[model samples]
Target: MDKEKLAYFKEKLLKMRSELIDKLQKKYAEAIDIGKGDGLDSADEAYKIYNRNLMLGRVETDALKLRLVEDALKRIENGTYGICISCEEEIEEKRLEYVPFARYCTECKTELEKKGLIRM
Candidate 1:
């Protein structure tokens, strides 16, 4: 890809990373507050548990996204941003458009899925 295209994808990934971080931070703070609340009612307990679980899931997803964005940025640095991680092949532009952080081409991604290793 040309430098302009690479920079475009980098911009998209950075925007996504920033949004994910903001959401994760906000949810994490809310979860902490819920944990500190003193109510012991059943509804309160359920809400706390739900919030905790949701926050945990969000944290994990956010961590993965952070890694993906970092990897993508590293790719930009190394001049390999739109290549498949498994096959070292060029990823489809359409796929990249849909998923700016994609690190695998369709074939490799399908193979990973067949191996029960789907990323998402």
Candidate 2:
């Protein structure tokens, strides 16, 4: 990829990273005091537990995405952005546009998925 394109993806990734961090912080704050001693009845307590779990799950997903974005940024620093990590091939621009943090090209991603290597 050209320097201009790389810069574009870097900018997008940075924005995404910032957004994810903000979301994670908000979710963490919400989850921290959830279900505290509030004299809630059993139904309310169940709802609180459900919401906390949902928030925690979303936090985990966001954290994973943040790590991927950071990794893509590192790849940009190393002059390896837009290349598939598994095959060392240039990933298509369209794929990158859809997923700026993609670490593999479509073929390799499918293969890894079939092998149970890629996380859901």
Candidate 3:
């Protein structure tokens, strides 16, 4: 990848991480506020369920994003940011534009799916 493009992706990834963290923090604050009130039984139960689900969702999404950010940083360090992991080939520019964190080329990704390494 070109230096400018790599820099752009780096900035984007950092921003995404920051935004995710901010969202999670806000969610935690909301959860705290919800927990502090001894509201109606049904409302309390619903709040608990909602908070659990929200925490789980945020955890999963943030974990994936963190992995992507780490992988991108590794690629930047190893000088292979735009290269596919499975094929050891250059990844499609268009695909990278759509998913800057992709570690495998389309073919390898398809193969991994066939092998049950991935479901999609």
Q: Which stretches of candidate 2 lie over 4 Å from their true place?
A: none
Name the better of 2 and 3 by TM-score. 2
Q: Write the per-residue lDDT of candidate 2 for residues 2-69, one digit (tens) a residue.
A: 98999999999999999999999998999887847598889999999999999899989999999999
Residue 109 lDDT, candidate 3, scale 0-100: 90
Candidate 1, residues 1-120, lDDT tens digits: the string is: 998999899899889889888887887787687677575898888888888888778888887888888888889899889999888989999999998889899889888989999865
Q: Pick the candidate with the highest TM-score.
A: 2
The TM-score ranking, best first, is: 2, 1, 3
Q: Give every collision pair in model 1.
A: none
- On lDDT, the leading prediction is 2
Please give the CA lDDT of all the candidate structures. 0.86, 0.93, 0.77
Q: Write model 3 residue lDDT over 1-120, tens digit each, in one string.
A: 789988887787777668777776776666566556465688777877788677767666766776787787779778899898888999897887787777888899989988899642
Task: Give per-model TM-scores.
Answer: 0.89, 0.94, 0.76
Model 3 regions lying over 4 Å from their true place: 31-39, 42-47
Q: Comparing candidate 1 with candidate 2, which one achieves the higher lDDT?
A: 2
